[model samples]
Target chain A: MALCEAEKTFILHSVEENFRIDGRQRGDYRPMELETNIVAPSFGSARLRLANTDVLVSVKLEIDSPTLEQPKLGKIEFFVDCSANATPDFEGRGGDNLATEISNCLSSAYKSSTAFDAGKLCILKGSKCWKLYVDILLLECGGNLYDAVSLAVKAALWDTRIPLVKSVVVDGNKVDMEVSDELFDCERLDVTGAPIMVTVCKIGDQCIVDPTTAEEHCSGGSVVVAVSKSNFSTILQTGGGSLHPMTLLESLKLGQTVAQRLDSTLINTLKQINDNSTDVGFLK
Target chain B: MSKKKELVSKIGLRLDGRRADELRRVRCKMGVFSQPDGSAYIEQGLTKVLAAVYGPHQVRGNRSKAQHDSAIVNCQFSMAVFSTSERKKRPRGDRKSSEMSIHLRQALLAAIKVELYPWSQIDIYVEVLHADGGVYPACVNAATLALIDAGIPLKEYVCACSASLANNDIPMVDISHQEEMLGGPTLTIAALPMSEKIVLMEMSQRFHIDHLPKVMAKALKGCKDIKVILDEAVRSHVEDVGCSTGWSNTSQKIKV
Candidate 1:
């Protein structure tokens, strides 16, 4: 991963010309390949490859009592597992810190009710609720991990199907609920308000979205902006370097714009996914 | 007796319609990731595993672990939290995963020619994306393919498989999770297929001593079969790359 001064200068020069080293515009993203419903028996699953960064997200649901504080709202938990396959540096417990940071960011991004409606997951208010466990596995780390992880998580949530509750009966604190027996009779999560994150890197005083690993190395600082349908859900500055207030504002603007575009593109692809279609997963 | 009848059906088919000796269909691809020196993905029945090999570079972290006479082969075996029907609490650093890592290193150490690269280390990591049984064997096979992709020197291909006694008489090869649950005993073996040398052998549950030989042989046979399939994949992969690179390595492809 070491880049000598000459290579850094070459990258800097390319960025100044409004062209990235990969012949992409500054605001452009790498080609991405996405597949959904790959993990069997899970409520929903998605595998997204953004260049070399590979992410697999799966949603699993379990019935449980609602939290005392959040009585009416269901729970949504994000777990990120950075696999050692991504790099030798992530061996054993080495990747736990990064995994925690990513999961926390996701939690914050989805905190707003406008962004994600957790109330819909509640089954019987305080008595029972459906807990959605959104597990994300990072298989590779090319770059722009935040953006790729968010996209895959959004897709997985969209694909998740919550089984219909047939009936519920309560008798003297004893509650019994029957879930639907039919497999296909399930309700899909409405993900229209889900947030999409975009990473805007400051490379040589210019902001660029979707920075590759090499670009990330040459950049000074970056901001991750998670944008929902109407407003920015979360904005966080990462990496070691500092950013000026003006540049930070500029990066946020850029991130929000790019995130909007990315969200629509993702929705289009998700809609195109069909079970009868021959092209599904790794067969290609 | 009633439950035992389910392992092998009334006619001859087992669960998933495979005969006792038949292995689950194996599909694999090499060079899966660009960051690693070598990487591979493998699917055996419902189980899927990804393996990546790094180094023969300088030994990393705690130089005391380095060896002067031979390269150190470090291994880590981890499964995704959502890989199975139930969520796993931890991916690695658990007792089971640590044990798996040690077993994996032992199996690979037997085949890797580590003496040639003194003061260096090779790291083999396997991530199980799905677990339906035969996880150890899948990890070993995927690592072998990744090592081959890395152009590492090896005594021979090291492959592994799991087998079990279906009834009192029939021996099943490449046992799946369902079969392992129904069957009483499960035997797993890792071997240098060409030399027919057993690097590691493990048996869980009890089986008659007479049944041991047949089940072990069946698992070894499964390993040999896997090696052949892997060898074919390697050759075809090399040929494809050669064809793309102006056919200069045409002779090399033939030799393989």
Candidate 2:
């Protein structure tokens, strides 16, 4: 969506006045609706709608050997698929660049030990571990995709449950493990330190947390900051324009504060989610 | 060898307890999104599909492909990585997905009034959230609802259904994934329910030629049944939108 000079000026002036076209202040995020465990087959799943940016994240687990360098840690991989339903422009491989960008950001954000501890996923140290495939499907693109995707990913991770292993026997380099037969015999993943990303868009002089598509188009530059607990995990500069060092620092601070608030709110919401609630996947 | 499990039991009930002719529960809602011109979500038993329609606008990417007499109908069918029991490496661009996309276009092209907007294009995208069974049929049904929500002109509703031979004697409608895995010849057909026209027909694992007519007839009946359900949903959706806009209750309006 191309914005005319006048429209861009209007958005810039609105930002300078500490107001946005969508009636949100610089720090206010749009209303978000989140649901977890919607996908029946996956280990864990979540669907989040930050206004209109719809993101669905599903986690599938597979047993595999841990990486040679990281013998004590398991693995987590992020794959983002841009569904054409979001837009015609993303029909074939057109959305690959954006998908790659987002997935890379997520992988980097979760790379740190403090952000996400993969050691708990390890089953038999270097021999066997659970590999998490975090698949994100982009159903719609309203705006603030980074924030929405991260929130959904975090929720899905929180909802993930690893099957409990009864016993593991290692005999002459051959390992055998017995998993509990009970359906509900599982261990929930610890997501206290899971990173939450916030995309702070710099329009004119002010930075905004959640920018609509129109606001994104008008913004000169944006910083995506992934905050895990109190520390910044991965900070990425997106879009074409560049920002001054002082402005970048200011935006980073803004993103960290907003991300902390968002993370706490999401954790509270997840705690309140009823497991027996009727699954309303997409029908609603 | 162990005795083969039954696709349909002697009592005529299938594995899921559905009768030989009964379809799985179908629940759907239209206009689920605000960004797209039209969008819909449909759940056929455990298989869920979401479809979005955009256009009747000027052709994108390749202007040279624009037609002089009819618009191009572009369709994309994608399944989520976690849709099936095992995770898929890629959502689309696979051979099966490409073929499904082509089949979806063929089914939709038969009903859509493409000539109404020449030199234009209509884009339809369907994403499978779950893949219990009859994925193509669910996608077709969902796309039809999205087209209607987009207010696209159509000759008639295009509904798709699957049928399979159970025990090599009885014909069953709405083949679930379990039934498909249980060794049976499955036939799928996409048809214009009102006109009784078959747009696309595909069969897997050949059966006796003598069984074709019975299976085809069962599948056609299934299509008609699905059409009725889709029509009712579309009507209610339209009525809901109309009521919300104050267009349905004209008598309540005061004289200007």
Q: Give the number of the best model, judged by TM-score.
A: 2
- Deviation (Å) of A248 in candidate 1: 1.5
- The reply for model 2, stretches above 4 Å from the true place, is B252-256
TM-score of each: 0.97, 0.98
Model 2: colliding residue pairs: none
Q: Which lDDT values do the candidates have, in the order given?
A: 0.91, 0.94
lDDT tens per residue, model 2, A21-108: 8887889999999999999999999999999899999999999999899999999999999999998889999899999999999999
Q: Please list the residue runs of candidate 1 whose C-alpha ends up more than 4 Å from where it truly belongs after superposition.
A: A278-283, B248-256
Model 1 steric clash pairs = none
How would you encode candidate 2's per-residue C-alpha lDDT over B134-163 as one tens digit per residue? 999999999999999999999999999999
* lDDT (Cα, tens digit) per residue for candidate 1, span B1-256: 7545567777889888999888999988888888899988889998989999998899999999899999999999999888889988788889999999999999999999999999999999999988998999999999999998888999999999999887677888999988876756889999999999999999999878988899999999999999989999888888776688878654543462
C-alpha RMSD of each candidate structure in angstroms: 1.6, 2.2
What is the alpha-carbon RMSD of candidate 1 to the true structure? 1.6
Quote the positional error of residue B133 for candidate 1 in Å: 1.2
